[model samples]
Target chain A: MTENSLQVSSIEFSYGRTRALNGVSLNVEAGRFVALVGANGAGKTTLFSIVTGLYAAHAGDVSIMGHNLRAETLKALGKMGVVFQRTTLDMDLTILQNLRYAAELHGLSRKDARERISEGMKLNSLSDLGKRKVAGLSGGQRRRVELCRALLHKPALLLLDEPTVGLDMSSRAGFVEHVRSLCKQYNTGVLWATHLMDEVNHDDDIYVMARGEIIAQGRVSDLLAAHSVDNVTDLYNLITEDNKNVVESGA
Target chain B: MSWLAALRCLRGVITREGLRFINQRGRFFSALVRPLVWLFIFAAGFRSVLGVSIIPPYETYVLYSEYITPGLLGMIMLFNGMQSSLSMVYDREMGSMRVLLTSPLPRWFLLFSKLLAGVVVAVIQVYVFLLVAWFWDIRPPVMGYILVVPALVLGGLMLGSLGLLLSSLVKQLENFAGVMNFVIFPMFFASSALYPLWRMLESSVVLWWICTLNPFTYVVELVRFALYGRIHWLALVVVVVCGVLFLGAAVIGYDPLRGFLARKDGGPRAG
Candidate 1:
């Protein structure tokens, strides 16, 4: 049986009075790339935090590789790799040291870690920068290092949270292409969370979130068709119009 | 997870902390200089003013520097513990801690490894201070140096565990100043580190009781005895119990469901 690499069901989370995630749910199956598109305050990060076990959900079930996150946290987390919204690399350490730390954290043997780091560095065209401190790397190089780190463990599921926020257009395009290639090459499941409209391709599966709920989900083309719109921006404006009104009125 | 996996994780954390300690020259110098100031300048001022009677660890009358060596070592561990907590909060803010927390290990094991790594670094600093005190003629028996390693580890564990717990309580770097003032200063001053229980009793009964109640007092006493090739059984038991409690509390404090990370509005603290 083919199991979803990630399955988040009816997850709810709150910060005292503010409900950040309200009955949110989604899934990413093996070998498929799924985009979780949302506005700035659409609860994408909150949901990701819960799924990654940063914060326990007030209510919900999250399973990874058919393993329940709460009951089998280590097994669930073992099958995944995550690139958080911010740069998590230690600026003080050299690129090689940072990656080695991640590799060791994932429990790869010395031989395996060395082989995989070499391959990942080569794959990201970061071979020459291994000895350089992460603080000296450009934004694009840092992001590449992060991607290499995330893939070092060969995770079955990869989660990226707004990874290309500050990159230039060409760098963003290159990063996206590289991630897509990695997904197809390894048959890895991907949940790419972003607020940018340009990142979602016409044929890719997408989930549109607003105000802590998934308002629409399907292939990009299908979502446009279902909403009787011709483009992503129009589709977003049409679906989130009510949410905007509610937020405006509440404010 | 398997034993090899855990060992790899432990090695990784320790290496990272060790590398950080090596790279931070200011930190290294300060860790040495802080205790040396007390040993050289402060102890010299107090040598004849406040003499130490024949303590168990010392067969005859010991000079002020000799009496305060174990206390200075304990102070090193205390400051090192507080530094670790400050960095934990800073790491939480910067998002590096997110990567560590999400690693595929038991949370308890990950936390314990972090504690052990920090204590190991502090132990090295303790030894360096011992080397400095050697020049000051505060030398103990040769075996005393070898045996003091275990005592330092035990004392470091207790202090480091407390640091881990404090990281969860004071979430912001700005608030850490208060922690140093409140936790470090009070613990350092009210403990047996600076003076003996007898001295405190001579000063005031209430002050003596406060020193006796302080867990850091037991840590100092434990290190003091171990450095002389002896064991203070009472101090040993107290340190062990306090270590377990602090580690347990720190484990819970970092817990996603039940601890400080459970339901916060602004999220984790900033550096």
Candidate 2:
């Protein structure tokens, strides 16, 4: 068995002549949380798409819990959960219905689905809002509902693409803490992609992406030290700015 | 996924579609209204001009409403098919499609389940239209109604599969209205929905050929015959074959590799 819950190796993807992902590779071990920080159009969403099986990579492999994505797609997907950049909940449905549907899509029986949904709602502080329509929920509430939906099946790896965008400061902090606790409690691997520097912590593994490439990856402290910087913000600036200069000067 | 699991997913998808249809009351009213207006108003006005020959299940000359009732039934499925496609475009744009595609089941099972769900909704609309037509005194034989079930299912699947194929090709919701004009109108007009193929042949042989070539024409004919307690074998074969072909293409269009959605984004590109 592989230690990595999610492994993306040398994956390349292109849209016409515009390369969306250029030999990008990363891994998340079981029970570890990795933060992926990148600017807009930095291929974070593109990489997420490939890992979620929404798009095929031009080259290389993605494995979820030791199942190769392309060769054993069903098995691989069965072990993964995803929270897309945009909210995907059906606004017309109640929170309960949304979670129930997600459970069924993952092939859970009704009896099992009911139990899991109730447990998920309870865990996410969404127990009272089960009957309420998702459209009526606050942004933070809806995001929490999405998290519950993704976690209902007890996926081995949870991939979130900027899950906290449009959230308030307090809600963002709440979300970060909740996700951290969930990861520890469930022993689940998580790859959280975002552009916000504050979302990442000192001890977390940080992968900085730019121009479809993983330019730097390490603990925040190590990254900062390697760049001769004192903090995460400075390290981010140095790497992205340095990559841009190299590209611009070469072009 | 296990067969039972696949069945569960199908149940969920179908239930969601049913709930969506029920929630949108306006859509229900409109889906029924269009066919009713055509049956009550258009058929009445055109009855005098369009004379009918003694077609099977009719020993005597029939009313235009009766003649076109089956065609109108086909029309319901046609419009619903396109509406389902429009919903697909909307789903894709709103990001819900990603959630659906990421399900752990086989991709083909997921796509087929979605198509089946749409067909179920269209069939419900079709039955409602038939009931209203019966209330309007455009009644078929009681046995014809019973036999029409299989025909409606087949026709619904055929048209719904075509919608699936169209949805895979159409990228944006804003561009779908143009597709309605180009695909829906041409399909509805070029088929035997409003007029008999003989009438089309009398007007122009070219149109008659086009009508003959259109898959919609076969579905319309299949429904027409089934509603009269008869079977049109050729049309049945044509509709089934077309359904299979369209469904196959749609599954390919949704394939993770080389699929329309997975291919180039933003604009069209040459191979």
Q: Using lDDT as the measure, which candidate wins?
A: 1
lDDT of 2 at A100: 82
- iRMS per model, in Å, is 3.3, 4.6
Q: Which sections of candidate 2 miss by over 4 Å?
A: A249-251, B267-271
Report, for candidate 1, the interface RMSD: 3.3
Stretch of 10 with least lDDT, candidate 1 chain A: A235-244
For B1-271, candidate 1 gives per-residue lDDT tens digits of 7999989999999999998898898998998999999999999999989898897988999998899999999999999988887888889888898899999998888888888888999999988888878898989999998998888889888988898898888767798888889999999999999898998998899999999999999999999999999999999999999999998998898999998867456573110
Predicted candidate 2 versus true structure: per-residue lDDT over B1-271, tens digit per residue: 7999899899888888887888788998999999899999999999898878997656789888888888888898899888987898888888888888999998878888887888888888888888877788987888988898888889988888898888888888888899889998899989998988889999999999999999999889899899889999999999999999998999888887878988748421110
Complex DockQ, candidate 1: 0.59
DockQ of each: 0.59, 0.55
The C-alpha local distance difference test score for the whole of candidate 2 amounts to 0.88
